[model samples]
Target chain A: EDKVVQSPLSLVVHEGDTVTLNCSYEVTNFRSLLWYKQEKKAPTFLFMLTSSGIEKKSGRLSSILDKKELFSILNITATQTGDSAVYLCAHLNDYKLSFGAGTTVTVRA
Target chain B: DAGITQSPRYKITETGRQVTLMCHQTWSHSYMFWYRQDLGHGLRLIYYSAAADITDKGEVPDGYVVSRSKTENFPLTLESATRSQTSVYFCASSERYGGRDGYTFGSGTRLTVV
Candidate 1:
């Protein structure tokens, strides 16, 4: 079975602080890694990392994949109170995605 | 106007009843997936379709059924609703395969079984 694990299930940080979320996986056929942010409703897409060492960035959020290490990390720089949400990591295959338990981030002002 | 949508944003049904959740996308995405979310379990895939009329089961498929007769529509049905089936069901679609672009999710349907 494909499995994805995330560390530090919950975290608290102050505004302007940087936070790093980790994700590791074990799958039969690995294709890519994805990150998502969920507030109260459906999850919104964050980043999709396919190659190693190449970081995908959008505003204050960035992510990188390490295929050799079988892991990925999502970093939030200069975080704001609006950045408080559950961050999810998923390992993708041709058919389905295996998701981690998710890291709940709480950013206080 | 060009995104995925789900109907019956909220539903309430009794145990042993039958219910169906609807999903439609306008992007002509080839892959559609159904997932259920709980408090701690995150999102667990219930079923997915590669294309029209080609459906496959996922991690949590029991007590559920799905059909993809068209590329833009995928509906999930609960044969016999149970208390354990109460969850927030989300519908997602991808342009290509699973690994290309990240999946686009619907607002989700909150189902309550009493």
Candidate 2:
């Protein structure tokens, strides 16, 4: 069984603050790590990290994967109210993708 | 719409009854997946299909069934619904194998069993 662990299940921060989310995984056939943001409906793709040390960024959101550490981190800079959502991290191993419990981020204006 | 779509945005069923959730994709992706979301569990895969007729089970497949008779459609069925099955169900599709390119998800269906 593949195991995924996310830190700080939930957090609250005011606008303009930066938030960092963490995810760790244990899998037999690692392929890539993915980040998703869910507001009230479907989850939207944020980033996919396949290599270590390199970071993927979009607007104020950025993420990086560490294959050696078996973990990944997602950072949100200058957060806004619109950034309040559940951040999910998933590990793609072979044909299956497993997700962690997710981090609920609440950005207050 | 050129994206994944899930039917019955919300559904309410009784225990012991059968319910089927429908999923469709307009991108003609080769891979489709079904997942359920519960509090504190994030999302757990129930089933997936590689093609029209190649379906496989995932981490939590018990009490659920899935079939992909067409390339664009993947439906999940609960032979005997239970309260424990009440959750938000999401359907997703990917264009390539292993979904290394990331998957596109539908709006999801909120199902409740009484």
Candidate 3:
């Protein structure tokens, strides 16, 4: 069975603070790791990491993957109230996705 | 619109009753998937289709049925609703399965079983 685990299930941070989310996975035929942000509705795509040590960034969010360690991390710098949402991690293998329980972040303004 | 859509944004059904959730994508992606999100489980795949008439089971598929007679539509049917089956259902599509680009998801349907 493929397993995906995320740490710090929930957190509360003030505006301008930096938060880091962690994800670790164990699976065969590994393809990629994906991150998503979910508010009250659907989850929107954040980033997809396929290579080791290569970071992908967009605006205030950044993510990197470490294939050898089988882990990935997402960083949100200068978080705002709008960044309060559940961060999800998924492992893509053999055309299927296995997701973690997710980390819920609450940004207080 | 131009993105994936799930109908019946919210639904309430009684136990033992049958209900079907509708999903449609205008992008014409080859892969479509059905998933359910719960408090602790996050998201779990129920079924998926590679194309029309190519449906397959996923992580949690029991008590659920799906058919894809058309490339743009995939519907999930619950033969008999159960309290445990109540959750937020989401429909997603991808032009290439497990490709560099990830799947695009719909707004989701909130189903409640009583």
Candidate 4:
């Protein structure tokens, strides 16, 4: 079965600290890796990485896919209170996605 | 604005009852999907349709049914509700295969089974 596992299930950090969330996957046909941030109602898209060693970034948030290592990492620099949320990582095959358990990060001011 | 939307943002039902969650996308995307969100599990796929009149089972399809008779509407029905089915449901759409482009999700529907 395809499996996606995330580490550091929960984290608490002070504002301006840097945080790293990890995700490892084992899928039949690896297509892509995606990241999302969920606040309350629904999850919002973050980044999608297909090629290994290439990093996708948006503002203070960035992600990189390591196909050779079968994992991905999400990094948040200069974290703020607003960055507190559940970060999800998913592995895609065909049109379906297998998601990790998710990492909850809480940034306190 | 053009995006996917789900009806019945919230629902409360009893076990053994029938419930249907509605999903519609104004963009007329070729692909639509249904997913259930539970605490700690993130989101799990329930069903998906590649186009009108085409549908397939996903990770968790038991006790659930889906139909896409039209390109814009994909509805998921719970034949017999169960307490375990109580969770947030989300609808997503994409113009292309989701592996590369990803998907756009609706606001989600919170279903509570009593």
Q: First chain TM-score in every candidate?
A: 0.98, 0.97, 0.98, 0.98
Residue pairs with backbone overlap in model 2: none
Distance from true position, residue B58, model 2, in Å? 0.6
Whole-model alpha-carbon lDDT for candidate 1: 0.93
The whole-model lDDT of each prediction reads 0.93, 0.93, 0.94, 0.91
| Candidate order, TM-score descending | 3, 2, 4, 1
Please write out the lDDT profile of model 1 over residues B7-44, one tens digit for every residue. Answer: 89999999999999999999999999999999788899
- Candidate 1 CAPRI-style tier: medium
DockQ of 1: 0.79
What is the total number of backbone clashes in candidate 4?
0
Off by over 4 Å in 3: none
Question: Between 3 and 4, whose lDDT is larger?
Answer: 3
Better of 1 and 2 by DockQ: 2
Cα deviation in Å at residue A51, candidate 1? 1.4
Cα lDDT of model 3 by residue, A78-103, tens digit = 99999999999999887678999999
Candidate 2 docking classification: high
Candidate 4 structure quality by residue, lDDT tens digits, B1-114: 678889899999999999999999998889999999998888999999999999999999999999999999999999999999999999988888863556888999999999
Candidate 4 chain B TM? 0.96
DockQ, cand. 4: 0.74
DockQ of 3: 0.81
In Å, candidate 2's interface RMSD is 1.0
